[model samples]
Target: MKSLFVTIVSLFSLSAAYAQTWSVDKAHSRAGFTVTHNLLAEVDGNFKTFDAKITAAKPDLSDAVFEFTADVNSISTDNERRDNHLKSPDFFDAAKFPTLTFKSTSFKKVEGKKYKITGDLTMHGVTKPITLDATMTGPVMMKGMGGKEQEKAGFKINSTLKRSDFSVGTIPVVVVSDEVEIKVNGEFAKQDGAVAEKK
Candidate 1:
């Protein structure tokens, strides 16, 4: 009976040590992209609506789990005509595939403050595995509205993938490059009920 009790206690302790959940602050976070337009210059755009849930065992996010989704219809490139066209069947087909998503398969520490995140990205009714180079920074404390201290963490990610892989568009490389570069900047606030010490 004592051995069983001890084992159960150890399990609970381990769980407590690793329990940390963070909610992304959308107002302070951005999921955007840059792509070559007509092979003349790179155009930038952002998705206005997105959400992410992140959990980590450490402040550095070495073994974190991240799930992110963006509304396909929220894509904007400053041109209404272009944006509308992107949502058509020629590109995202937002009517059929309303969301683009990513769920992490692994977050491995590469060096100081840098990590390699591998995940499957689904868009335009297709899924493909992609690796992102990411950097984690900050666990800074700031006073909240109620005068309570809030812990904030930030992450920067960069990745590039071939649009053809997801069948986003039929345009050739000469017209609009097949490769798209993704930039993700996220700020997460530690939610209530977090027992782990902020780092």
Candidate 2:
């Protein structure tokens, strides 16, 4: 019994030592979306403020966990009037729901560098499960601010969601397409000495 207990503890410690945390480099990251307008053209927009993090134990990030949050007020479409209208009650009501968030429940590899991430997205006080397709690039070692070697990775994630699912807007589908295409590109830097144990 004693030997078995020691063996289990040793294995646990080894697993914990492999876990790492990577933080988004906001300067090189962007969260944006596109939606069709009146069947004529597509409107593009993006959120100016957002943050995300990833935790994993493997180099391939097959068991990674992702968490993200974006400030609703930071939304921008280049037009002040339209942006303001989006913040009103007819749309996001940013004052009441200040932020949108997502936390991954599963991260599975579909092929080389491609993954499917399923998570719960919370927006406008509604929480729903959503899946996103992601492509991951290098956890390459690069020189950093102090000329020290740092590990960096890149990700491109995409998804399509319905605005009505989150009670986001009251506009008719004919005026604005119901399907919104989301695109997120980010570069993450692995934190030094940040150990993240698996739950």
Q: How many residue pairs clash in each candidate?
A: 0, 0
Candidate 1 wrongly placed segments (more than 4 Å): 1-18, 194-199
Global fold similarity of model 2 (TM-score): 0.90
- Top candidate by lDDT: 2
Angstrom error at residue 137, model 2: 0.5
Each prediction's whole-model lDDT (CA): 0.88, 0.91
Per-residue accuracy of model 1 over 1-199 as CA lDDT, tens digit each: 9999999988767666666888999988999999998889999989999999887766655557899999999999999999999999999999999999999999998888888999999999999999999988877888878899988888999999999999889977888889899999999987777555344
Native-to-model Cα distance after best TM-score fit, residue 76 in candidate 1, in Å: 0.5
Error at 145, model 1, angstroms? 3.4
